[model samples]
Target: MDFTPPQKRKAEESIVPMINVVFLLLIFFLMTSQITPPEPFEVTLPVSETLGDAESELTLHLSKDGDVQFEDFTGETAWMRLGGRIDPQTVVKLRVDAALPAPKLAQVMQRLSPTGAASVEIVAVQK
Candidate 1:
């Protein structure tokens, strides 16, 4: 038997593989994720007693100041831009501020008519 005791082996565990796996998973999630578009602006919708399920491909937002916005455009120009994009057979969703006057809302509806939208749905929050 040897006089000296056997040397203890270093208990080293490699973590590089674990780190690589974590990074790969992070990249996978980032690549597969879908991001939703942000709202154009803040809006206070009117209250309604009856809620209906309505879906539309196009949306027009009306601010309390009587300004109409669609996508990145505003005012009359926005309406003109929207007219070009509207489909005759698709419904248009209108989100108007509750504080907006009725006449302003009517004006927006009138402008939409020339676009030949099949229908218009006014969006309102349930009471």
Candidate 2:
């Protein structure tokens, strides 16, 4: 019998389908991801030209209408009630509307004094 040159075998694996499946999985994960909205607050902070760097542990939003809200804290309580039992070592952030009266702001600060709150930082947009 005559012997001829043996043929080379081709690779058995096909990578196209595997690549497509990987891309599909990536897209599915991105679409199914959850996006949460920021907490609701009523205050409109005034702007500042020069702001300092500070880390806020708690945020208190006071609206122009005299409504006060506590954010970044767990539990529901009025501003005055909240001041009674806050950690003294944590920093407090006060975000107040630019239009709010100075007296009201002072009152709010006074209420926060009794709380063991470490220090108060005021945040506002640049005017």
Candidate 3:
């Protein structure tokens, strides 16, 4: 039987285009993703040049009306009903309206300060 060698199949093309497309998609997503800024409450905060030194792993906010809110890692509301996940081992940032009465603020601060909280910083909103 006369058999010519079966025609050799063309070698597979390189996947570089597919890889590039994937990388481009990844970069596009990274750039296009929306980033939420910090929430705005009604009261204005006092500014401090030294405030630049204030850093926190978690943030708690006390509104002027005596309402409390918490911020999660994504900087979104931690949900008062669901409560918050605070690690006592780390510093929790406390933001209070400048107008809130000191005793109320102190009580709130005491409640916030648990064994794991590394430190407490009372932050005032900037006007």
Candidate 4:
């Protein structure tokens, strides 16, 4: 007759590998994700029927108070900075506040004409 206690089981498997796999997946998502930075200034985009994706490196921002912001520059300085970056072939993405008046928008367009913009696309939300 056998009267012996069962051998002790090994301790629970180490969770280090699971943790490593979880970290690896987290890193994969972080690398593969496209994260757009927050806008330097808040804006309420106008609604329109225009439907197309334009990914321009340079974006021009016009606030409801007619403030201008291009990349990190703001106000008159933004305009000057924009001038140096723009050329006849540069596509400028203009994000104007919805509350901004039409006249102000027109004035902006007029001023942009002198910058020799190849094309200026107004960023808007689709209806």
TM values, all candidates: 0.77, 0.61, 0.55, 0.85
Instruction: List the lowest-lDDT window of 10 residues for candidate 3.
Output: 73-82
Candidate 4 TM-score, true structure as reference: 0.85
In candidate 1, position 67 carries an lDDT of: 81
Question: Between prediction 2 and prediction 3, which has the larger TM-score?
Answer: 2
Give the lDDT ranking, best first: 4, 1, 2, 3
Q: For candidate 3, lDDT tens digit of each residue in 1-127?
A: 9778888899999999999999999999999998765665765565664544458756676777767766432123444321345555577777777778889887776665543566777775443
Ranking by TM-score: 4, 1, 2, 3
Clashes of 3: 5
Number of colliding residue pairs in each model: 0, 7, 5, 0
Give candidate 3's error at residue 50 in angstroms.
Answer: 3.5
Candidate 1 overall lDDT versus native: 0.88
> Candidate 2: worst 10 consecutive residues by lDDT?
72-81
- Predicted structure 4: lDDT: 0.90
Clash pairs, model 4 backbone: none
Residue-wise C-alpha lDDT for candidate 4, range 18-61, written one tens digit per residue = 99999999999999999987787789999988677766878999
How good is model 2 by TM-score?
Answer: 0.61
Clashes of 4: 0
lDDT of each: 0.88, 0.75, 0.66, 0.90
Top-scoring candidate (TM-score): 4
